[model samples]
Target: MRIKAYGLVEFTKSGYVKTQAVVLTLTVVLLIFALLWQPTGMWAANPVFGFLEWWVLLVLIAEVAETAIMLLKFKEKEAALR
Candidate 1:
């Protein structure tokens, strides 16, 4: 695989691209719902919704960490190639 400066090659190879896309879509949908419907109260009052929100956040955080790791590895590989 060709190593690019941005390190996207490794990120895509690790298969987190699809997961990040889905989580990002879900986050955007949830944000729109919360904004248009003003469902902040419901999010807090409903256990299920609250849990959903937290779950999304947790998944997002995990994805971020995975991406960071992949980027770091890519950087190391690029450095070694130099």
Candidate 2:
């Protein structure tokens, strides 16, 4: 069940934090605009939809973290056995 960091090593990271920082900045900009728009009395209002979208985003975040952790563990095991 070894998970290889081969691709990462071969491709070169330039580091994860750098790319994640860029993404977080972009997401913040979009969120700010989405939240600041003044209502024209005709704008779509759907709390349920917003809640569902947030829920899905959270699930995706959790799944990504879980997968990364699993891969880390696998790599550790592979290293330990060597």
TM-score of every candidate relative to the true structure? 0.49, 0.42
Q: Model 1: runs farther than 4 Å from truth? A: 2-50
Question: What ranges in model 2 sit over 4 Å off?
Answer: 1-50
- The 10-residue segment with the lowest total lDDT in model 1: 1-10
lDDT of each: 0.60, 0.51
Model 2: ten consecutive residues of lowest lDDT: 4-13
Task: For each of the candidates, give the backbone clash count.
Answer: 0, 0
Best by TM-score: 1
Candidate 2 per-residue lDDT over residues 1-82, each given as its tens digit: 3243434432112334344457556655555655555445434465544454454456557655754664566567768979
Clashing pairs in 1: none
